[model samples]
Target: MDVLYFAWVRERIGLPKEKVESQAATVNDLVAELSAREDRYAAAFADLSALRVALDQELSDFDASLAGVREVAFFPPMTGG
Candidate 1:
């Protein structure tokens, strides 16, 4: 899957996007796997409540299924000016 990071998430993970190979069934599972990989990933996913997720560009939740998903993006919630 292609995992993308935006805003501060890219800053923390040090990459805007990367291909990931995993057996995760859900978004939260993927997060746990990444968080276990390094301190940077852990910091990037420190608070799920502070972040938002997208599956193939569609807004999704951490518990959302990853079936047939080709892309996943993580970013902070947007604010209106």
Candidate 2:
């Protein structure tokens, strides 16, 4: 799957996107896997509540299924003035 990072997430992870080989069943599972990889990943995914996820370009929750998903994007909630 291609995991994309936006805004500060990209800053923390130091990448805009990357192809990931994961056996995760849900978004949360993927997060845990990434968080365990290194300190940077851990810091990037430290607070789930502060982040928002998108699956294949559609807004999704952390517990959403990852089956058949090709792309996953992580970013902070948007705000409009």
Per-residue CA lDDT of model 2 for 2-48, tens digit only, reads 99999999999999999999999999999999999999999999989
Which prediction has the highest lDDT against the true structure? 1
Alpha carbon lDDT at 46, candidate 1:
95
Candidate 1 deviant stretches above 4 angstroms: none
Report the C-alpha lDDT of model 1 over 1-81, residue by residue, as the tens digit: 999999999999999999999999999999999999999999999999999999999999999999999999999997769
Q: Model 2 RMSD to the real structure?
A: 0.9
TM-scores of the models, in the order given? 0.96, 0.96
Clashing pairs in 1: none
Q: After superposing candidate 2, which stretches have Cα over 4 Å from the reference?
A: none
In model 2, residue pairs whose N, Cα or C atoms come closer than 3 Å (at least 3 residues apart or on different chains), thus clashing, are none
